[model samples]
Target: MAPARKKVVIEGSVSCVYCVMEGGPGSVIKTDLLPGAVVKLQCNNSRKGSWEEQTKTGGKGDFSFTPVKVSSRGAHKCRVFLVSSPRGVCPLIISDGAVLKPAPPNATSPFQLFTLQPLYFYPAPYTCL
Candidate 1:
């Protein structure tokens, strides 16, 4: 008989920072939380093959994938990508994704939680007069 694989949880968020260049240099004006943004989680390993999963950001720009059972080797090969932005909200210029790395296991929990750096969207280009 084979042993049951351990379960793990992955989560992260998406946000946008507005930068304005009035005279000398550009500066970030404000940061906004993006909701309803689509995020995709992909995992690939030469031995186990590959798979993908997706979820949308909540009202607070938070997104989480359901607990999944993955081997230790497969967990390190996962990555999170920004799939799409909410229509009429923020448009993405670059869609570079982040690699998923395993964090230290929690002493109280049986499963592991993985978090990625917050994905960002570039604001539409603006012309300065």
Candidate 2:
């Protein structure tokens, strides 16, 4: 008999920072939540191979993928990437995708929740000055 697949939910958020005279004595940094930003989640499993899913951030910069059913080991191999930004002023510079981390197991829930570090963006070069 085959084992039943497990359900998983992935969640994350995006943010941006505008730095004026960065690294200087009087430098200033402004941070804001990014809404309507697009992000993508990709996962790989030995049995089903690999797949991708995409979603946009909410008004509060939060995003969550629909529940996905996969082998018990599949949820551990997923990554989240920042795709697009709503503000052209805050272009993605030196952005890196984040690996998903599963929260501690819970007895009351049938699905696992995976989280990624908040992705960030910065204003264009020389624009924040």
Candidate 3:
């Protein structure tokens, strides 16, 4: 008598670009959503309280969920409540299976550069497949 375990379903989603840049995924949003557009992937591991999973949006703007797995991992989040691009909630680029830090120096927001030959290392474009 031992057959009941399907709790470890921690799927999440909503990583978007909606279009106007022609980058990678689907790139074309002037207000056209119909590939799987329902838009709602609210998740919560901690940012406030209550928000298990809702799941929608799959037209390249994507959304997914299957939560039930929890052992206090640290942090987890997923949100995509669309309007035009970003309004209510949206956050899921995924990087929590492992390797959470050591890759956070690609920072560039508006402008901030002052290097006279001291520190600004750049060699990891994609070299550790």
Candidate 4:
């Protein structure tokens, strides 16, 4: 018999900086909406195979992927990666689970963003390996 599978949902947002004076560090005086950005999620399947899912940011720079499945006796993880920008000019940048603080009138509000955490499943002691 097969064990029950678990479902997990992964989501996040993307944004870009604005108002640059002298290029170096902290050049961005503020941030604006980066709509239509691509966000990808990668994980391992039960067969030890690689799998990836993608989603696009909306006007609010929000994106979400379908639920991922996990089986017993295996591990699954979905890591978020910045794929591309909306304007095709700016490149993708990996964020440390934190989004850029957007300015007013379309600024992305601060929220509790979650990072990818590895999901592990274990079999029963009485069950065979």
Q: Of the candidates numbered 1 and 4, which has the greater lDDT value?
A: 1
TM-score of each: 0.76, 0.80, 0.20, 0.53
Write the residue-wise lDDT of candidate 3 on 1-129 in tens digits: 842222222222333322333332223233232233234334455546555434445555444333443321322344334323332221222222221111122233221211111101111121111
Task: Report how far off residue 119 is in candidate 1 (Å).
Answer: 0.6
CA lDDT of 81 in candidate 4? 65
**Model 4 off-target regions past 4 Å?**
1-5, 19-28, 70-76, 92-129
Model 4 TM-score is: 0.53
Go through the candidates in order and give the clash count of each: 0, 0, 1, 0
lDDT of 2 by residue, 1-129 (tens): 754455787888888666646463234466689999888887776677788888999999999985454434576777788888889877754555698787776767777778877787677673463
Worst 10 residues of 1 by lDDT: 19-28
Model 1 clash pairs are none
Error of 3 at 100 (Å): 13
TM-score of 3: 0.20
- On lDDT, the candidate that comes out on top is 2
Candidate 2: which stretches are off by over 4 Å? 1-5, 20-28, 67-72, 126-129
Model 1: lDDT equals: 0.69
User: Quick one: best TM-score, which candidate?
Assistant: 2
**What are the clashing pairs of model 3?**
79-90
Task: Give the poorly placed runs of model 3, Cα more than 4 Å off.
Answer: 1-36, 52-75, 79-106, 110-129
Ranking by TM-score: 2, 1, 4, 3
**What is the C-alpha local distance difference test score of each model?**
0.69, 0.74, 0.30, 0.47
